[model samples]
Target: MSIQTKTVKAKTVAIVGGGCAGWSLAARVDQLSANTVTLYLKEETNPSHNWGFWQMPWLSDALSKKRAMWNSWQIITDEGIVTHHSRNHAYCSITSDDWFDWCQKRFHSAATTTEIIRLPVTNTDKNMLMTSNHKKRYDLIYDSRPPKADKNILLQHFKGLEIKTSIPVFNSKAAVLMDFRVSQENGIHFMYVLGYDQYTALVESTFFSTSPHREEVYDEAIRDYLSRIYNVTSFEIVKSEKGIIPMGDVRPKDQNPFLYSIGSNAGAIRPSSGYAFSFIQKQITQFLDRQTKPTNPHKKHDLMMDLIFLEVLKSHPEKAQRLFFKLARALNGDSFARFLSGEANIKDYFLVINSMPKWLFINQAVRVIIEKWKRIAKWA
Candidate 1:
């Protein structure tokens, strides 16, 4: 005779926010354990925008839906252009709408006990989440909301226009990672171009500054860059996208055991580069593998390096062009991509450190250390 054992019920999970992190976690959590997921979308749908990242094995499905890709990319400065090519990882772009849809399909196909609710989480008490309709308790809750912005924090802001030119102008094979030929009056300004085809491209005017410029400023810069660099006088704008990313730590203050902050709120956005897509994916993957709340995906050493780089950028905005140019020249395509994607090895880290201005970085590192010590003292 065999004795019958009791079956355990699935844990309930409520995920807040409809963006990349929320959807990503929701899609993959079933792999960790048997769980019922309730996804709370702030809006009925996600806003459409392009997310760019380097290709990786884990992201093969995403690569299938890429809008465009480049095996070779370049960084341009007044000094010259430095081009790098990586056969291992191609730079690819995917639209938010496509990504969200793919995530939804994956989640639904895998988990039958999932619900998608169109409501914003107003407040929380322990494991209980309050929505406009009702309050529900879950074993776990993941909040992917945008972090509150501070005026003093340096921000990476940009406005991109996807345009189609009548003439074959843009180079479709290579992407312009950073063109520092733009006006520097509005902080560390640059032009980023992603060419989809000879006649189509997404041109963005980007700035790393505390104070973002007006919409017209970005538009004017884009216009000037297109006319000057590409010699394009006329082009039809297909779509436009604008975003502002805080180049500062966004770790949550409250330590709720059942509640976790994922995505950018968990510091997925690199303080120096403002790259979040790949980091967010890394955070989710780790969370699934560990079966716990997501933590900052970036390595401590990488974060420290980013902090020092930010300090240098803040202190010497004028030197931004030269600094970035030097960095691009120092690393090949694979190393640069790995470094930016937070997968850098010791050699990659050494290359980055050696590329920077010695004295400036040392001074910044000291400043960062002192500031940390002061904060510790104040807290104590």
Candidate 2:
């Protein structure tokens, strides 16, 4: 009897994008493979961003540090307010700074070949990354760069204002996800926070297709939201953040020979929810597990949520915003709770999509069909 094992030579990975995805992928690749991993970061300072995931069972262990836990959210509607609570799980929020620090520290000690190159990457075949200092080649490349900003593409633009009040007005326990009492116009929605801090609260206003002064709009919305929800007025602003999440519903081509897309660039962001941290982690782990054989690449999930998501953003951005708010307003407390817990199934997702005004969906579908038909007619 004999036992045999084969060793596979590792490939060099050049990650050209230094957000959560770049650092995370670099760390994981360094940990899992005997390969050399280099992170090409856009910012020397860790960017201030927020990453939240549903209360996944594995997240407790996956996250290096725990920042906040929230069990309930206040969903506001034109009709009224409904409180959704889940005893089973609490949504977790982890700061990008913490994750980046953890990744840097882990990669330093992981023994796997890892480097963080502070530079920008150029898009080319020979050296996909072109820095003024040098050009580098990688067997595998992970690009996490944000899509070039375009007003044409419908996007989820948000501004988060982190406020610290002199006296505590926010509950230290419950997390408020959405206070829809404000305006749900032109596909914009408002999400308010009350539970993340002892004396701090985050008020966020989001728009689906357009970019306005998010900070300005958020401050105005918060003034109203807090006054309505907590009946409290003046609060001091400690810090603020604004981010544009490309709801780019378009699927990117496998552009380069060794290039692979990761993070939101790879379409990990849930089109419906605009959340991707947990999904990206799952995607990376599954990808690494399947990479044992060079010829066997990972299969993309067929759900094609991106396709539907893009269409909604392109044709019916307004309706999409309304639908999200409508569903949030209409759902029963228990079902909404389940949805937030990520326990809801595909059917639930579809149900929420279908819950919107049928006429609106129909009109949007008809418009898309007519455009396609016209294009075909012109081609013939």
Candidate 3:
């Protein structure tokens, strides 16, 4: 466990894994690097994942042409369809291929000692990292590979289908957050996004289930949504993608010395919503801000939000579901739209959550209180 201090010298940062989190961190480190930075991707191939988020201007430079831009969004429910005009945010999307191109372009533009190595990293940090084929060393290591999680814990997974048609049944300007009409059973959330009617629509169903059985559930849900809601059976499958995001509180015990967890491995994914892109970006920004401090890279404020939200999620999974769905119902149209786009404020967030059946919110509140007491008692 070599814990090196940050001297004025150009320190080498070896970031393992070249996904959105790894690439984005590399780009930022390149910007901040008074020293050198290196990126390692396990796969020798270019990126092949579809990455998307409500387009925040902060990440505009990293967005690729596969990124689609939308101005409005919606949330569908059994009650009715509600739409909101996006005021502060635009729904932007980028495919994995496009995002890879964008990051490589940025890496190319940077003058720092930034290099992306396409090889697997050796598990040991003692000597020069000796891979089966190569050797390398770094002043610091950031590993973003999927951490082995406790399987007994449940994780929320989703499979999305990107469909296109000649006769668009979706509103070109609006993006749906969650279609509650898709049944609230087994902790599932459904959503649809229409990008300019003819371009394509991203429809997804999220299940608070395991990665193993998500495909069948998603396929069945998608087919049902298309037939009952869209009233269209003859649509071309433009593309399909699925993502597994951990929604549990369990994390790696701070037992590793030199290697620090990053991205989902670092507990950067939001527990309630499985949103990691923005969260990991935020963590990287903060890490850069305090990189000079004498502290463990993994032990930071990043855990605060994760812990808080995870408590809510684990203690009251049903309440978590109810809270979100109720917010979808309360905010309905445009409010729900702007909220997902990351434009809504704290007041807006609370107002929407507050609208759920008061008893459910009360139950959530009580659970939180009890959990906190247990923690305090244990510490005492």
Candidate 4:
């Protein structure tokens, strides 16, 4: 008797970092196959966070259960408020503690070997990860370390406070996506308020500039908005969260099939808008289809459009309030979400370009094209 046999190799994957990017990747991978996965986390303690990503098809049902969802969101401008409905795909948020717990539970339930180690892995040095406990070399290792931006990068920095008010205050049904009624002295300033309920919410003062505004600048503005706008004065600060995301020029994309670079380091975050959760979710879902070291021609049109948008904002920071509000008004509900997710087609984008301040955008667009072609000419 002749028998033909095949040996299946166990795929071992290692992910370094414990932020939303790493956690999501591990959870998705674990759900798909019985492959061994190791997680290296730097934070010994959970950094409480509220990660909000637009609902996507790849978003697992298990993870969806833990999020706080919003059906509608409003953007405040000098003219008035523009509200967008998320009927099909809602804007959702999940806490860091809950996400970490979910990942841990999944790993524990896995039939294959899986671990969430607290050891910090800096570089891709294989021998360095070898220890008394773990000595196996990973077939694939993903690095989620956030890269440091240049000094002139336009940052979306914010300081938020999640407070519990004495009485019902916030609009529990609709979230305040951006209130651009604040003073624009220190770059473009706005308040992002998300309400879990009428009594509880996260009120954040956000600034779009190179350096963050003073703590007092945000603190005072937040208090004023609460008192003046919502009539919310008596409230206890439950917790505070702070973050900095890039809203600058085009970033270099460095990714590969195996030993991939994931998260913000891989340019998952949209440069014009500081939204990476959706992009990260999309990238993690396609574990096998990642591009290695993306060049200018990969998504040339989309990248160029985003770069031009960012350039307009950087060159004329004062125009952000008008540009953002107008852009929101131009796009429909579905299109707005698509734009945020970086999946907007030419038609959707053209609608936005037409809504902007023509002179401001036109000048920036010309400069961006000239500079890009100049670089190409030199390289050629």
Candidate models: Cα lDDT each: 0.85, 0.62, 0.62, 0.73
What is candidate 4's local distance difference test score?
Answer: 0.73
Best by TM-score: 1
lDDT of 2 at 215: 60
* Pairs in clash, predicted candidate 3: 10-35, 49-96, 67-93, 73-175, 74-175, 82-333, 83-333, 83-334, 84-333, 84-334
- Candidate 1 on 95-121: residue-level lDDT in tens? 988988888888888744889888888
RMSD of each: 4.1, 5.4, 4.3, 5.1
- Model 4 TM: 0.86
Q: Taking the tens digit of each residue's C-alpha lDDT, what string does model 4 give over 284-320?
A: 6554334232122114566677888878888878778
Worst 10 residues of 1 by lDDT: 1-10
lDDT of 2 by residue, 1-380 (tens): 11111222346767778776677776666544656878887655534766766566545544547577677666655656666666655566887778777867877877777787887775546435677788766655667775453456656777777777777678767676665567665365667574566678777776666555546676677677777866768877766777767654534343654556777667666655566677667666656665532221112322233434466656654454455567776565546644544455666667656666766556655765686689899999
**How good is model 1 by TM-score?**
0.95
How does residue 62 of candidate 4 score in lDDT? 30
TM-scores for all candidates: the values are 0.95, 0.80, 0.80, 0.86
Model 2 bad stretches (over 4 Å): 1-9, 44-47, 62-64, 126-128, 148-151, 184-187, 250-254, 292-322, 329-354, 362-380
Candidate 1 yields a Cα-based lDDT of: 0.85
